[model samples]
Target chain A: MTDASLNTASTQTGEAGFGDYFALLKPRVMTLVVFTALVGLLAAPVSVHPVVGFAAILFIAVGGGASGALNMWWDADIDAVMKRTARRPIPSGKVTGDEAFAIGMTLSAFAVVFLALATNWVAAGLLAFTIFFYVVIYSMWLKRWTPQNIVIGGAAGAFPPMIGWAAATGTVSIESVLMFALIFMWTPPHFWALALFMRSDYDEAGVPMLTVTHGRRATRVHILVYTILLAALAIGTGFTAVGGPIYLAVAVVLNVMFLIGAVRIWRRDEVMSEADNYAVEKKVFRLSLYYLFAHFGAIALEAGLAPFGFGGW
Target chain B: MSFRQEHELHKRRFGRNLGLGVILAGLVALVFGLTVVKVSNDDFSVETQASGGQN
Candidate 1:
């Protein structure tokens, strides 16, 4: 490398600062976690005390931030290698890897302990496990070793709503499981779509993405399969206790459109991929964003209707 | 006071506002109040007071 020295910038050049450390938490992703977790708390059958609910969500957000920090800590090497990720907090010398690790561990402990104190032990335990799953299992293990990293690692992001539910209700339920299932199903297609267009990213980063490990053709098919399954699961959730006619109807229409998009991707030619560049892949990525917001919005709507006693399966 | 005291006061003015707690609480209350008001106007005459159920 001539592009930029891959050495830790924090020590050599001293780029690490307050903002850089904050950025390591991936606040954009944390915003999504907070919003979804709030929806889960609102939709839950149980009502947590206001302070308790606030504390639970706050701790959950911190846990999410902790995961992001640990992810940066571990992926520093790859971040230095990849163009898109070259300027990340750790790789750009904006933050030291050791500092990131320390921050992640501290936040992780604080989140789990405070969540347990504010909510219930069960929710706290789940939050702890979620952090471990993301930092230890996904960042440390699956991400470098296998192409299915996103598939399994996606579990970390999926647990927020379930934890929010448990925080409210003190236990797991079919509805929470379904919420988990919806996010779990969406992860594969969402990330694979990015991988398809950004294949060179994985090549340069040396990340074993499905597109890199198995070829773009295989990754495209897998995205289609997972999208279909996600659609099915999304629609099925509407029939559950947490769902209602509104959610069901919305799920059906959204899933149908999602499936159509997946099929379009699958049928396209790879030779054509180089020509169209990011069109198809970008479409898939944009659709995946809509897919998540729509599902959660429908859930929130169903809950809104419930106060009227006019919505349910 | 030493230089650190003056600097701390100046920084607090510019650093991330710590008053978000009340702001967030106010927002939540506004939304909850709006929901109650909307429901009251609607036909939800089930006398649903405060929540006390499980899913």
Candidate 2:
């Protein structure tokens, strides 16, 4: 082989490995799936055996990973240009696109079928839709075509717990739908806040994000609007069988703090936003991560106490 | 539209695509076999504590 050919082979071999394959799964997002699916399993009115529940969460996590892998595969080109995602499995050549695509497509089918076998058809169907939504709807279609990508695409991540709920109950309920809505509503604000700080990333990559398409000021305003809606939905979660005074208190405090941050961002100048300073934007971004976790954490708390009649029924 | 690196964009020949289909089908079958084995041996009716929030 010529020197250039040998080098290409070396780069491909070096890039594709077990770790890279695993990275394609996006473990951080998978963690959210596990937690939310667990909560859904716990929150359901019906009960599942411990072993079955464990299996359910496992398959759901696999499904989430499958979605991530497919997303990485499809977005590899865009990801290579974006600094934040430049090191991803496909982008780095650590995983061959065909391998990543194969893994993703394979896992999607596996997870959906197993979820159905282990639990019910409803849960399996939800998993199937979630995968399709993320890959076909969010990644392929919505991403390049519009700025509303994150708003609608976020629903893919929101379905796990509902899938878990259906696994246990074999049906959908207001509770499950609300859980889905909580994430769906929370996603735009959560992602838009990050988009504000990383506006340049979207611009250079030409992903047509809200900030890139509408500018930072518009993105901030949208973030605040979505944050308002998200905060309201979060606090509202406290009123159902999932809520109590403790959960209510947590929501009020978190939402208030979140609102203050959104307002602060709204007031900041583009110069200030683009600066290296992390005080305001950093807080908002970090809070966005914890915000969803805290909400779910409170839900878990309510469920744990509900059986004892400690928290509200 | 663009390949991240040389290998990621290797055009899948018919043989490669067929191989992928077989591998994916095998994985589904394997997982299904394990699931059926477990279900037959273990009681699925056993219930435990429900998990999260008001619902």
Candidate 3:
């Protein structure tokens, strides 16, 4: 380990800034959590007051950030080893593990209690469960233990929309369950693609990613299988209440493009050079980002148009 | 930076974090206050009843 990695709460380097603390929140991931949660709230059958909706999304975002902070604290050692995550606040020596832990615990308590006050106990309960699953179940246990880590841990990411739905309706329904399933199915192909390109990072970090544990060929096959399953689920979701002409159109086009990318990835030979190998994987990873955003956007559009009788046949 | 300067910087950052905590606490208080007000108000109850009846 380098000196940077050795530095922790005992060592005093540069003073941490607000931005450093914010970085501990994993703002990029929080953005997805907030967006999906918003879609779930908006797309629900029940109508929530604008204030209530705003408050719920805010608390959900905070809860997601709290999870990120706790995950960073727990995984700082592995994070220091991974090139992709080396610059994170804790790993980079910008913040201490103790600071990250304190911030995470404080925010976790704040987000859960306030969410219960702002919305309902059901939503609060889901938020609390998401934090526990991410911090303890995924970060502490499954990540180091199994190659199927993301497969089970994906549930942590999948619960935001369900929490949002519960916040609005105070109940879980088929629509919210489908929303959860959509993300749950999409996560494997998404992360595995990144893992394929960044295999060395996981290897160095000693993370039991599928690519490290199962070999590239098996990972490729898994990606293809999961992508096909995801396509089926995504397209099937379009016929539900969350779907309409807009959502269905988006789903059909995106899933076809996604499947083609997955197939191209699966067909590539292991002997191919790094640049050529990564190009297809990178394209799939980029497409996966748009695939999610566009689907959620279409759902939001359907919800917006529902009152005009242009939504869900 | 000198040792004294670094110590001042640490103090400032601590103050900023404290400010952030206070602000967040205030937001929590505001949300709780609004929920209390809504619960006590007849208008909110009527709105809830209207929406419930529609359902």
Candidate 4:
């Protein structure tokens, strides 16, 4: 090979840009982490300094991103096999697995230590556990072993809001747990809907998704069951300290719509799904996103209005 | 005149280096701000001998 060609090849493969490293952090998931954690901080009864709150959220997001990097490193093999994750930094060859591992470890330590110094040890400890849970428990152990992987692994994603509340109050509370529960229960149905449409990806990767392990019919039933439970939790949260009139209204409307969507999903067979390209499933998935965002938004609204005498019941 | 073209790899490396530099600088600023906030808060006050005597 000519020097020019060698140089071209090296440029294409040898070094990754800033964006590639950022991609290793799974920025999309970080958005959810940041948002939920912010809501947790805001919804807390105790007031935190703006700077401290910002730093807490930043560290939580970094901790979350660190776990994402580790998850990508551990799952690089399956990620390559699955079309949905084939383009991830590790799988696409933009970043090396060792690099991902190193980054994950370094950032995990940095985030936890900095969080302890900035906020309280409780929040920092929770962040540490979240990273360990997502990487070691969820990614390494459960993901390949069980069809209920997403169900159990969802806990890692649910901890940020609780961590945020702890950052403010230095203790856990029912309100924070309710926020955590909202996400925890919502994760199964949200992911299952996506799995229904993208069944082949998990099957190809041998990930043992509910759809692949128990058939699509069973997966549909699981979706409906989880959604019903989630709806109950979402609406019930309306009466909690975190909930207010506005929150109740949002929860009622969204949960009703979510229930209708879930029922529709449960009733449809594979033939009906394929005929419409899983349109209903996709729509429900989209609504799930709105359902979560609106619920959290309502909580934030309640918190925002609290001092003004219009927020809580 | 002696001239050499910078490889594309060099540019990417430069960008990565710059990004890390910015992030490190931001961390320094954040730590500084946190220290200031902690020190200014009443809970963080150190009790001097005179203050302890007064109490």
Q: Report backbone clashes per prediction.
A: 2, 10, 0, 0
Q: Which regions of candidate 1 are displaced past 4 Å?
A: A1-15, B1-55
Q: Sorted by lDDT, highest first, which candidate order results?
A: 4, 3, 2, 1
Deviating ranges (above 4 Å) for candidate 2? A1-11, A275-278, B1-55
Better of 1 and 3 by TM-score: 3
Candidate 3 positional error at A157, Å: 0.5
- With a 3 Å backbone cut-off (N, CA, C), the pairs that clash in candidate 1 are A9-A93, A16-A94
Q: Which candidate is the best by DockQ?
A: 4
lDDT of 1 by residue, B1-55 (tens): 5656565545544442434455458657745654554456423444353232321
- Tens digits of per-residue lDDT for model 2 on A227-250? 889888888888987778778888
Per-residue accuracy of model 4 over A1-313 as CA lDDT, tens digit each? 5322332243234588999999999999999999999999999999999999999999999999999999999988777777677777776778888999999999999999999999999999999999999999999999999999999999999999999999999999999999999999999999999999997888877888999999999999999999999999999999999999999999999999999999999999999999999999999999999998999999999999999999988
Question: Which ten contiguous residues of candidate 3 chain A have the minimum total lDDT?
Answer: A3-12
Query: Each prediction's TM-score against the native?
Result: 0.83, 0.83, 0.89, 0.95
lDDT of 1 by residue, A93-195 (tens): 7567898999999889988887886678989999999999998999999999999999999999999999999888889888888888888889999999888
Give residue A127's lDDT in candidate 1 (0 to 100): 93
iRMSD (Å), candidate 2: 7.4
TM of chain B, each: 0.47, 0.52, 0.67, 0.75
Tens digits of lDDT, candidate 3, B1-55? 5656556788768867986898779797767766775586677889999999998
Report the C-alpha lDDT of model 2 over B1-55, residue by residue, as the tens digit.
6655545434333345665577579657756665665666534323222322324
